[model samples]
Target: MSGWLAIAGLGPGDEALITPEVTEALAKATDVVGYIPYVARVAERPGLTLHASDNRVEIDRSRHALEMAEAGRRVVVVSSGDPGVFAMAAAIFEAVEVGPAAWRALDIRVLPGITAMLAAAARAGAPLGHDFCAINLSDNLKPWDLIERRLRLAAEADFAMAFYNPRSKSRPEGFAKALDTLRQACGDARPVIFARAVTTPEEEIRVVPLTEARPEMADMRTMVIVGSSRTRIITRDGGPIVYTPRSVPA
Candidate 1:
């Protein structure tokens, strides 16, 4: 089969953060499929078709990319941030698992990019320097009860946390409840970093105590990170640096 499918990450928001491997795949792709904003990032060129679709249609998008690849079209599935992190790579695999028998034989690849969680953590001086865990705060795919359970458990284990899809206009209460959960579970007044639109022109990074991290301070565009008990702040002339110690003294 000459056709292949490449599930690629476009990085967070900055074009420069996109990996050279993903850029090469896009250049070779006969078709690009992704959410509207991600597809918009790919430059239009001759012999390349872009398929932009709505959010919640991941399965359909995956299937379409698979079919196109089966038909010998070089297809690239794009996602902002690392495609495997709450993004399109898993969706593509999910479709392939239940798809036609021939799909299993198709050449498929997942190209990595800088995920928002890491990008956000980097902007905050490695608040994730120690052991950490990433969680999707959006209850769209999972129950809120499960999310809360994991939140409490991660806190109980003293793991620094990075949250994605923290708040949206339609789901304002969830993040508020999350903040409350962390405050009650963590107990200590650790730092919370809110990195919004990282690497973009509108990028904003705000550091505040866990007690002051309001739901309103975060939006869908924001990456929220809550530090663990071992996390410390280095106050400097410019700004404070938040980082978790690399070791835990037993």
Candidate 2:
């Protein structure tokens, strides 16, 4: 590879969320490669070349970025939220010269960003302070049966749960399926935190019981957090927050 691989994270959605370092990487890069939606987030940077692709075309995109770098071009692989969290960083590494010749010739740097789970947790007043696990209910990449098994284990262990790709417009029933699994293991009253379009326009956060997390309440843009048995839902002066106790020195 010709240049450094900056796995820059575009924080949340606001333009102000972009850090000086991230901006510099974008400012200096000759080629910027990323998923289509993430690449669109980059405002017109003068003379920057962009290679955007479909969402599922991750490996191809990574390979393309590497090819550009091998051609003596500085390339920055962009990812929304943290590049490592279900994003480009892993794909880049996977493609980075795995062979002795490949590993010896490439340079890569992983830059992290504000992940949706953390952003959503912040809006909900810390529902993930203690032991927690994130699960994607989508069966597109992973099988639904195994996802169901993780849901059972997480709920049974009373772990705080953050769901990425919780639901989509077409197969919106995934969240419902997850909730059903959780409710079956943890009972119906498990606290559920819903955040829509976090940090962007039309951001919304609310807490409901697990049994009450309706399909109408979520979509592709929504990230859902389901709390454990220790989670508490507070309604103070009509503002809602879901709090999970943190264990200090005992």
Candidate 3:
């Protein structure tokens, strides 16, 4: 049997958020590969082999998946949220690009899913309804200077921002630096949302003014959204609804 490889997104924490295309691909896969947690999300079956590895071994994992596919095994490489968004899809392409030329001819497809940014935005009443940009705040592959520049530029452009990999046990100071940079650049009371483990049983959403926002409010699991100056919050008896107007004034 001719084998193929698919890079699929499992969506944020909720299984229901996973796209039908990804589910179908997973069900048909003879081998599944991903980070330990993401691979754990897939159920075991008689015919499927699961390959789980450390989070930092993405390229290694991608090469393994490609090798499996080359050996005539249908493979699905899983990722949390969208595979194209800071996930396995890019890593797979990178591996393909640098590996054997025959690897380029292998069948490969990317299946998108709901990213945490969108899921968090949906639960927060559309903070990203207007122009926005998503940034990965971790300084792992990139330097902190670049991240700071993007943050400042995004603030200056008045674009709403969604931040991923905001904080971790090792890099606890990054988020704090980010908050200070935003506070200095934006210089306004726009709303900032802290959405933790969104769409799961541990979900927690907190809305606070930018001035009052703290670094500790966010972690690796948190999706942080900072509104543009044009963003607004409508308060009611139920709760405040945060959204950016569809139109911008001249």
Candidate 4:
């Protein structure tokens, strides 16, 4: 069939960070499907249809993209940040796995882009330079207990961490609890970096000690990183630079 589906990441917020591959996919797409804001990023072009949907409807959106592809339409499924990282790529695969057998043979590709964690890390000067883990604190797909357990374990293992969807209107208490758990497990002085709206006009980056970190510091637009024991902050005339050294004590 001439139809194919491409799940492409638009990167964090900057148009410059969007990869050429993703741009080409969009240019070739007859249909572009994604969250409302992400779909809005694609310029209006002749012969291109934009399907913007609500958040939390990933399965339905994936199915729509697949259906459009099956009809011989070149479709691009857009996502912010890397599609494979807590984004549409997994949803697409999950739909395919449980979907029709024919879908398994469809031409599908996942084009990676700069994820929010990486973008946040770079803006903060490489707090994730060492071995690190990424965690989604939303608890929308998983249980709160599981999130807490993972946070404790990550701290015990001394792994630097990047967190996504840290706080939302409905889940404000979750991040507060997470901060408390991290403080109890990781100690009082570990640095926590809150990077909001990275690469966008309203971009703001803040670093605070774990003890001083408050739940209100994060919002849906924020990406949070909690440093390992070795994460360091260097204060310069411009600002502070955070980084984790490559070597550790023997």
Candidate 5:
């Protein structure tokens, strides 16, 4: 078939941050599918169908996109931030792995975009400049105990951390536990950044010490970055810059 499927990242929020590659894929798409908000980002036009689904039905969404593509429709699955980073690309692959063998032969491509952590880091002056790890704080797919264990271990490693899905209405306590774990392991002096709605009109960046950070500061829209023990803060006329130095002692 002349059909193809492309999983594309729409970047954090700003239209300017969207890569040209993803933009071109959208322009050529016969069907655009994704979570409601991300799918809504695609402008409605003639001959382009938009399939916006709920947040939880990732496998169903992936399958719908694949079916459309196999039927000679050029389909694009749009994701906020990078698709590979805790997003739709992996879900699509999971569906492919379990589905009919024909899916393995379908033309598929992953078009990367600027993820939230990178956008958030740029706004806060490179808090992730050194060794860092990105963790999804929501334990929807995993156990809470495992999440807590990972948090403690990350702190012990002294790696800068960028967290996604820090808090949600259903699981408010997870982020609070994360804060407690960080405070105990990383101490109270390290910088903790709460970057909300990065690159959008509603964007807000706040850098506070671990002692001052409250779990309530973050929501589903926020990306939190906790500095390593060596991370520094530079106070300037404009605002404070948080960054990790590139070199370490031998």
Candidate 6:
């Protein structure tokens, strides 16, 4: 509303997921920009311009959003999940890598959203309550070798991992490779979770051993949680849940 480009988060699919700050910013925004599917989730917002695009054009989208803000538009760039964790925040910052001082001074505020990892972890109990880390399986921007190295380190360290951007039509085998590496360090039967769509309609939470995961379930919409050696899985109220056990007194 103040002619500053405020990049806000709309959280997950549910409207109740939106925070008060995000709602206020959206109400005052003259325009919003995000991936088409994510932008479509905001059904009640009216009297505002919306710019939606494919996920592949991330840099272009940020540049365009900022350009509109520079033209005195109250712009709100949105991300489906959280803006900071593997979302639009990085892209917008990347767009300003070689910007003018004035361009850098443009007001930009990022609001946090409920990411699929946190939502999935909550549904799956306290699997990530320990010293866990996250990794993206899609190697579009980063090479597979780098992913492989990280997976190797995570496996060696016995860290519980949340796998994001697991698979898509073009990149199918990244999960398999990561799983294979994990199996060598842990065991073939190590507990792993395949959580799909999260809070959305197509939610699927499957408790499968590391070796039992099929490539069919891995996709961009899915978030996979690989447990550490101390993690355990059980059924609770007809839902699969994972948790790391409390440490024993020495």
Candidate no. 6 TM-score: 0.93
How would you encode candidate 2's per-residue C-alpha lDDT over 12-79 as one tens digit per residue? 67677677788888888987888888899876667788888998888888888877776678888888
The 10 consecutive residues of candidate 5 with the worst lDDT sum are 180-189
* Deviating ranges (above 4 Å) for candidate 6: 44-46, 235-237, 246-250
Which residue pairs in candidate 5 have backbone atoms (N, alpha carbon, C) closer than 3 angstroms, thus clashing? none
Name the runs in model 2 displaced over 4 angstroms. Answer: 97-100, 248-250
Please estimate how well model 2 matches the true structure, expressed as its whole-model Cα lDDT: 0.82
Candidate 2 TM-score, C-alpha based? 0.93
| Tens digits of per-residue lDDT for model 4, 171-234 | 7999999998998998759999999999999999999999899999999999999999999999
TM-score each candidate.
Answer: 0.99, 0.93, 0.99, 0.99, 0.99, 0.93
Report lDDT (Cα) of residue 15, candidate 4.
98
Q: lDDT per model, in order?
A: 0.95, 0.82, 0.95, 0.95, 0.94, 0.82
* Residue range 1-250, candidate 5, lDDT tens digits: 4999999999999999999999999999999999999999999999999999999999999999999988899999999999999999999999999998889999999999999999999999988888999999999999988888888899999899999999999989999999988888886589999999999999999999999999899999999999998899999987899989997898
* Candidate 4: regions farther than 4 A off: none
Point out where model 5 deviates above 4 Å: none
Question: Which of the two, 3 or 5, has more lDDT?
Answer: 3
Worst 10 residues of 2 by lDDT: 97-106
Q: In model 2, how large is the Cα lDDT of residue 235?
A: 81
Q: What TM value does model 5 have?
A: 0.99
